[model samples]
Target: MKLKPTIFVFAIWATGLCHAYASTSHEIECPTEISAAALAINAPEGWSAYAQEGLRLRSAEPALGPPEEKAFLKPGSTKSIKGGSIDSWLELSGSGPTGKWIVCRYGERGEITLSKKLHDNTSACTVSSRREQVQVSCTW
Candidate 1:
């Protein structure tokens, strides 16, 4: 997806073109915390799993198969979402049925830490930067 550098000009243009323009790099919120914990626990035991896809779908990163077999977009999300990258670490976050998610990648170690809210109904985890099913704010 080709990202539009200017965020104010548009919110949700083409589904694939828009990623995360605003995500919390500071202290996280409740939704973010829960998701992070669940993702850590859900990690498969005795297997070294890393986020192969930075801007695409991390869940389907390991699937090196045909398009029909691969799920590039997470459930409840129409398109793949991505946050900006800092150095080698790519930060990603979104809120929907997935609640809030975060993925941090380390360059040298090839480490990718994934997190997502397992169950959330009380808090929306959104801000003023959202428009219904369109763009939801990922910032704190």
Candidate 2:
């Protein structure tokens, strides 16, 4: 199989549903905590893994013997991958206000780190938090 460079676009909508766009790609939804494992096991054969921070997929069988180069994910940005086009998105939320971040990347043997920090806001009577680093990895 041949790999095409494609962009994965994710947008947060008002209803809390994530909107995603990619060229000739299919969408897969996984549980918030197990997204990394799900993507790895569910990826089609002959397609490698690609993910952003906090997300990851296992390596896929390459059409050729080995892959040319590895890919990495950028925080608050998108990355493209080779081989089969399998794209996915995950969301998590509780009762109060919510925020969402999306990252996209492609290639093999790639990794990223994700973290979170929480802050209390007395003025707004709300608790604010930010994800520090989210890790993602892929190999072929």
The best candidate by TM-score is 1
For model 1, the superposed segments whose C-alpha errors exceed 4 Å read: 1-26, 29-94, 107-111, 116-140
Q: After superposition, how far is residue 82 of candidate 1 from its true place, in Å?
A: 23
Candidate 2 lDDT over 1-140, as tens digits, reads: 65443422222242244223211222222113425444444558998676443344232211111122222221222334343233222112222232121222222343432222112111111111123222322111
Q: Model 2: runs farther than 4 Å from truth? A: 1-82, 90-98, 105-107, 113-140
lDDT top scorer: 1
The candidate 1 region of ten consecutive residues with least summed lDDT is 56-65
lDDT of each: 0.29, 0.26
| Per-residue accuracy of model 1 over 9-127 as CA lDDT, tens digit each | 55546443644432232332222112322343345788765543333222211111223333233223233234321111122233343343333222234243333332222222222
RMSD of each: 17.8, 22.6
Task: Estimate the TM-score of every prediction.
Answer: 0.20, 0.16
